[model samples]
Target: MSYFWTGEGGVPGDFAYGKIHLFAVAALIVVTVLMCIVGKRLSAKNKRNVILVAAVISLGFEIFWRGVWIGRGVPVLETWPLYPCNLAGVLVPLIVFTNNKTLKEIFYVFAFIGGIITFVYPDGIFVNSVLNFSILKSILQHTAIIFIPVFEYFTGQFKPQFKKLWLAIIGLFIHLFNSEYLPRYFGMEGDYIFLRSGLPFVIPGVPQVLILGPIAIIVMFVFYAALDRKGSKAALRRKKQ
Candidate 1:
């Protein structure tokens, strides 16, 4: 049992890869539906704002980190062959219960617990220790970012602050800095950092540490700015009640 639990066969990626038929994602779908419906019933615009921010951030992180960096060869199919977990697990619940501060707190609490369980437990559930840190970091990081804006949206606590350029720039810097120590310490490949190969113009070869680092920050800022703009609009709409 331990062998089946800890060995290669025990991990989620090993089992779930390409096997589009699974129950977990379905469970996420069900949770999404319930949360959205219930959340709407108890709704406040502020709560909706929280969820909206969460949804956008969730999508941004997934797209930039998961889809672009790792799944390089795969085409960005917007709709089908769907990977729905992030939307379901993170966004839907966030939007639904953003008004309920307790619920939001619970979600983050459990999210942190889930992160640890998924990574450290090694009990045949999931793998990818390399990517896991970033994923988990995003979860924690975005929890803080998404919460204030979202809470404000529903509560009419403040006006929507639209600083796309700064938001994007900060996001880019944060991600670059986040990646710096992890890859080196873990001895993992820095394939996601851009143009060690593939897209040459984006990140050139030089003092890789210095060169790629700033470029990565710039690229991330561009990507995040777009996402932040969308979120700000959504929050404003929710704020107007």
Candidate 2:
């Protein structure tokens, strides 16, 4: 139990990209593809239910994890609203339910790209930890971030316009500002964006942290190529109408 919550007797990076990690990603991709195959056929009620269930799970795990962190005596500045995944877990639900197209333009990218990166690499966190509460919570929460937006797209709910790319850039500016200044204001040492801190996931000589901005921009477009979205806007509009 202590291993589950407190991580008292666990090894770090135990499952990073091992079989379990690959299996998990494969499972999610399979489910996402299944959803894509039958998304348009699903009823509105069922779609809403699916979204609601995922949102609750993501938000619930985030709260639980935060409680664990606080209970374990981790600093608040370092834990809450600090990282991209943190926001993706905590805020993405609110953005979606509120139907905030603008925030979606920003966070949908976070939910997809940030979630994929962290979920895949998870170096210091999930990579090494045995299957405990921390690992379960981390996996579920990360899955939610990646799953929700992509699921929405699969269901014809979100049609991202490339011209709104600036919205995400501006959102990242705010994120970077908060990352650098928030901890300083609180008199705590922190690296929320992983920009100052060396990233656990790597690109060898190039600092992986520097790539986040460009990656964010690129992924806003890649959902099209990656998902094989054909006439996404027209399809989405036709569905909505």
- TM-score of structure candidate 1: 0.34
**lDDT agreement of model 1 with the native:** 0.40
Error at 57, model 1, angstroms: 19
TM-score of 2: 0.79
Q: Which stretches of candidate 2 lie over 4 Å from their true place?
A: 10-14, 75-78, 127-129, 199-241
Number of the top TM-score candidate: 2
Clash pairs for candidate 2: 12-128, 13-127, 13-128, 14-127, 14-128, 15-127, 16-127
TM-score of each: 0.34, 0.79
lDDT of 2 by residue, 1-241 (tens): 6666666665664667776677777888888778767766889878877787778777777777888788879876567686767777888877767877888877677567878888656755554546677666767777888888888876877767655666766767767776767768888776677865565445667765567667655666566434434555655677798
C-alpha lDDT (0 to 100) for residue 30 of candidate 1: 57
